[model samples]
Target chain A: MSPIATAALAKTAPPAPPRRRARSGPPTRRLMAPATLFLLAWMIVPLAMTLYYSVRHYNLMMPELRNFVGATNYKLLLTDPTFWHSLVNTLVLVMACLAITVALGLGLALLFNRTFPGRGVARTLAISPFFVMPVVTGLIWKNMLFHPVYGLLAWLARELGLAPFDWLAQQPMLSIVIMIAWEWTPFALLILLTGLQSLPEDQIEAARLDGAGRWQEFRHIVVPHLGQVLYVVVMLESIFFLTSFAEIYATTSGGPGTATTNLPYYIYQNAFFQYDIGLSSAAAVGAVVLANVFSFFLIRFVAGNLNAGSAR
Target chain B: MAIVELKNVVKNYGGRKAQGPNAVDDFNLTTRDGEFVVLVGPSGCGKTTTMRMIAGLEDLSAGSIRIGGRDVSDVAPRDRDIAMVFQSYALYPHMTVFGNMAFALRLKKLPQAEIEKRVREAARMLDIEHLLERKPRALSGGQRQRVALGRAIVRQPQVFLMDEPLSNLDAKLRVETRAQIIKLHRSLGVTTFYVTHDQVEAMTMGQRIVVMLDGNVQQIATPHELYAQPVNTFVAGFIGTPSMNFLPATVGDDARSLQGEGYRFRAGDARAAGLAGKAGATVLVGVRPEHLKWCGSGDAQAANHLAGKVDVVEPLGSTTMVQVDVGGQRITAQLDSAIAVEMGQPIALTCAADVLHLFDAQTGQALGLPAQA
Candidate 1:
């Protein structure tokens, strides 16, 4: 039964007996225990390990030097120029990809909203990009589209009488941005298409009869209705973008003098390449703080909206 | 205010098949200036499609629509000079009541002061003035609907199209909103075309109600005319609650009476006129539940009576509705609540001659009914 029908039935139904209520109370808490404990161990253990490693002078290269460093690793990593550069790169990658994907996704979603021949097949094909593995996406773009000599783009450039360009070498950051955006745009499109579909047709009809042209209807009715869905999309995309790594690893590999190295790549470099556990742990902690700060504002905005929702 | 005319308007969703069955087939009507017209039918009966065509929301498959004598077949919906209220109360969720009401005027580039004055006036009329600053998400369903109404009222468009605006409300609130819309129509006097699947709303609100079935108009008449003289069995059945009952009968040899299973009745002169030469023809006898009263023996209207066993009795405060099984057919009778009835009790039902309706069995079209009576 639908929730509204269930609610109405509850309203008209007699209240439950005291014995039935008492019987339901204990099992509810018991049923909730597994998920509660799982979430706590899942989130808290890794957080505890990161905090533990950040305070110690642990370096995998020389295990004998393990001792309490007491903020030294944090201070050194915070002052590093490469750390600042990676931070800037991370922000650029996230912001650029977000802008590209959202803009393109919104346009595609609007286009797909209308009835056209082959819409189901077209939508399925359009959404396929989101399902491709990130490493595969990187490899495909690198070898098939961006390579200077054998790539499709190179062939097109030569056909147009232009020089073949080395995309990953000369424009590593842009290449990574494009690769990541190509994969993630479908995520935005799917979410935004669902939102567009959920928009009531009556609203659009009402707007038209209210003298709204196509553009005005889109701006007033469509945009406002899609606001919450857009917020969810941005929040999820930004989080995923902040932790983006596979594309850069498979293609640029943080090369060209740290041009495409984001915070995750920086942590990987310190932990796996330099074998400096404490510093990488400190960097990982910083990334966590950044993610928390982003979520804090977004959750506040969403909660504020919820609290203002229709109620007596 | 303008006269809205739909000339042979038709709608069909079938692409590339011009000969396909229409959703709204060749509907035609012309409204007097400032008239409140309602299109009512069962779902998929083309009432909503007809209204949408007038609003220019749906393209006419053929024919043209005119507003005050100007053809609007090629005009866009935005340029058609109309406003609509939707069943879902489609208020812009992000906008305050004030903003929603002011939207159309602002789109027209009306001065800010004029927009404010018109919005405030409409809000006052809808009793939503105090909710001007609240977003639609912050309002109750009824409040949101008022804002939707206010949104249309502020536009003061040449025509008002409403598609089941009260369907989303609770029953009590729907009735209240129905009265409010009627009052709004009386005051503003815009040429209005309202669509609903509800016969009650159509009867209560429309100056003239258009009954439609299977994309074709069944009849166009006032509530009184529709209730008293439905042109077909469909209209007669659709317009009443509990609906008009149908029983197969044959004209008596004398042609002034009807003979059905287990019963016989005189088909009064006016009702028998069309059966003059069709002595043995099968016909359908129609009578509304209210018109069939539970009568004891020796009642004054003894000329027409059906004897049956009461199968069920529903005693509402004002009246008792009893379903009776007569022979193999069931008939409903509405009687005074003071009259007691019992299940399985043999009962007699009497209907006055003027209230009896006769219809051709095959065509389901009313017969022996004067057109203007």
Candidate 2:
């Protein structure tokens, strides 16, 4: 408490060291330059060419009749009824698949989180659908599961004294949603299960002692603990679902009067079948903008989930 | 407030009827109403497991637990009306301090005003009122520990079970919180069962301390009784710092004296009476470090004295500790700091016969009536 001792302590204190610069900065950047340049050239150059072609009246069949047509392709894409129908179908597919996969994945993950006699094998089997190629997933559902006369579901319905129902012919959008949900539910399950496993056991026991029932524990503790993980799952799955193509190509083929035709298939129809490269490129650019818009809204809305448990 | 009892409690990690060793075996204790009992033992000694069984977080394999004279063996943990504080201070990471403390009250569907009042009072008691809106991750370790304590205190349950709650705290904080817990127990007067492997914490906080070893209860006594009248060599060695020194010895043919490697001492009247028919029996002479005193190294063969070459000398502020090698066995003596000594020098030490503790060499059981008894 004396001034002399305080002055002596101040005299004995060491000076703070200066902050040092990172040593390997320039060399590391130089080493990474080749990959960076390659990514930029591949990604940005193609996007630029697509934007250029979208503003011109270019048709593959008439290769010599090219002309500047600013905003024409975009106006046509916006006003076309089939384009709007495909856009609506794409939104519905993404939303339906997300809801189905998330609900089913959480339910199954909670069930398989417990120990059982063959849990390892069960989990392996549960996630096997994620490994099946999208094309193959479509084929299996179409030929072996959903065919009205001979597929498994039809056979089961007939055996149960119920009328066999045609899936693709009557409910094409529903069939597409089911096929995508089947393939992607496993992805959600794998990530959500890992999140569930990281929850501390003592927290659960503490909740039990706090007089919380099962529902309360899930709502208050487990769900909040999985908040960040669920945000990641939803974001990643949304990007993949927005670009879904192969499953629809194999099963419904955008049939039933464009009921299951999404944005990707519409672009394919314009570029390959109709041979309108300008229209296809415009739709492709619109798809990119839509994806960005969806991600922007998603990040804004659910971004709070990421900061739910973060410290001050 | 209620009396809590464990009757023949057994817990086996192995499935029932598997014939494997129980993690806790035949453990039984009955606490007085509003008693603060501490279960202290080494790791893997089932002290926490016993507390968990009482809290109904663990199931009893063969017996029942009773709180307030009602069997709660089949009751759920929440229904048993007990609150537990875990070693890791399992505060909900997402919840603020107020939410953490108000959780149990909210689950009971109490009035909003009552819950608010209780949480505020508990937070004030714990001195964490300023942190009510902050999450657990935002708080320091000591603050988080206070939040955990506040969570339990706000419940006002019939019993409190704490599983090594102070183990995660730093040394100074642990001591401060240890005293805080004792003070809280005094004011709240709830039946509490605290588990810790630290002997000092058990000694300082518990009204009755249960010492366990390898799933078995070794002794149950108050702090002073556990210190001065330990039931066996384990309790004596465990309860003291630097522990009681065990020197192998033999009962003399006269049945009144004990002869060790380099010393012979006549037993006191009570010890002699306890050893009346055990002449020539092999026993371990236990003496606390502080009980031994340095005498002049004049007569090596004198009665009631030990001579040995000093191995190490540690000079504490008030008392010095000297480790001496006698007949190839090392023993430590707490001596006065004024006594100057160095390594490799011969020294003589003596102690009163009443300070000597005799235990069976093979069984390690104390040989006479306990000191307090």
Candidate 3:
């Protein structure tokens, strides 16, 4: 283009409005640097120490002698019968708690979505369990509700003309699961109920006008509408459930021959009670890898579910 | 087709003894088989509540609604065999157009072939056959509208209830879709009860329009009757664009003249037949902007002209609207754009002696209509 043409175009283009200078990226990056570095250090330090300790035999009992034993700690942990037992116990506990909380939570959410007298008070009471501290929840169940001889169950059994049953000793894993599910069910209710409320009233009304009964509406409309919400609930609850520790610690403490010892409890037992730092670190590393695997699979599954839901 | 009737239906929200007023009170109307009736009002006037009553979505508090001579006040909406098109269209987002349209038939346990045939026929009728496999979220607003109509059509219901179904569309689409719906209505000939707040919709689509205010029926009349001779001030003011202008007036004590805000008309200039004996009583004089003509020639009808300064001239392509101030009262005068007019142009507008309406001031009931033989 000629300079004359450029000048003519510039003149006729109304001289583009004065632009305000935007903040450059360097200042923003500088502002974020400290917090980002701190978080990175906070996460990396413990993880690096765990890795280093897992490879070397360092016990508080004999701190002067520490030497690298390549793959020995991992092989020992993998071959231990107690480790396999606790892994099974962990699976059973996680699955059972998820089933109980999700099923019961769905039922309660449905019931609470209806309008009735005192419904607000009832819903608040139903959600109160989620607010209870996990340790408090554990003790409330262990001492006041599940005591073998003098708990609420024992008293009730005596009043009913039956012998008292030792609940925790007989079913240690079952007791832990029940306690966890009770604490988490309200979390599920809070999420699922919100999903139910946001379901369009027009769709429900249209279904009713389409001659669908209550069960059909639930099966076709409400269930599908709540699908993504329930998926999120399950994923979140599963992540929390897999690492559950406080309830078991307060109640079972890996008692009765490791019956309630999930991975977290077992790791604590090896490190604190058994004084085997190498074995505990190895077990902790195993748990972390397994959790990452589970999370990866769950995220992929939910992504697929999301795509299928919207693709149609 | 079924005739729909509502007999003094009442709906009160919350509870019966709740402090709030009733939403609908003692409403009554009857529609013949294949009749198109529209309930029109401002928002919160209970037009929607009244239509819901007819569809059996809301239970009447005191009165009974009958369809085809059977009492259905207590019936369920589904059992009443009525189809409704909601303003949101309410299509199942997860389902394809065919599935949404065929949902009711599938619920009735119809055979697969029959459901397929009926859904296809309806889809073709709505000209949405190509969109049958697409979900509602994938369709445009106009396509979803057709799907909604097809859903209602496949049911072959006894009555069609539409609650502001076209209010969501842009203006051009709304007009086009409205014409299509009227054509479909003519072909189907099903009794339809439509509710809208747009007076134009009520005027153009309904065989008879029911104007409502404060949950009470103000007037139920044909569009022609409603435009020509509104029974009261509310109906008169509501039924037109550039709405009918009202002026404070009184019958002169001598009974030969009409004294108004800015001008007086002698006995020969203004003829109010029904207001003959109401001498010395204050009345409201209503005049449509179209009836007020610009006085241009020496032979102008000057005896009944309103003189004012033009405040604003609004060009409306075929015509122009000029807001005029006469004394302390403001009124609009619609005139031909060909008749040149500009801002601050002082002018006089007149019409024939019979083109004036007299309404009682307090009650607002029409005393006499203009030019009624």
The lDDT of model 1 is 0.89
Tell me the DockQ of each model, to 2 decimals.
0.46, 0.48, 0.44
Error of 1 at B238 (Å): 2.2
Q: Per-residue lDDT of A1-312 in model 1, one digit per residue for the tens? A: 999999999999998777756564567777999998999899999899999999999898899999998999999998999999999999899889989999999999999999999999999999999999999999999999999989999999999999999999999999999999999999999999999999988778777877788898887888767878888888999999999999989998898889999999999999999999999999999999988886788678765764454221
Which candidate achieves the best TM-score against the true structure?
A: 2
- Positional deviation of residue B215's Cα in model 1 after best superposition, in angstroms: 1.0
Which regions of candidate 1 deviate over 4 angstroms? A1-24, A27-33, A293-312, B293-296, B299-302, B338-341, B371-373
State each model's TM-score restricted to chain B.
0.97, 0.96, 0.94
Model 3, CA-based lDDT: 0.86
lDDT values for all models: 0.89, 0.90, 0.86
Q: How well does each candidate superpose onto the true structure, as a TM-score?
A: 0.90, 0.94, 0.91
The CAPRI category of model 2 is acceptable
- Please give the lDDT score for candidate 2: 0.90
| Best model number under DockQ | 2
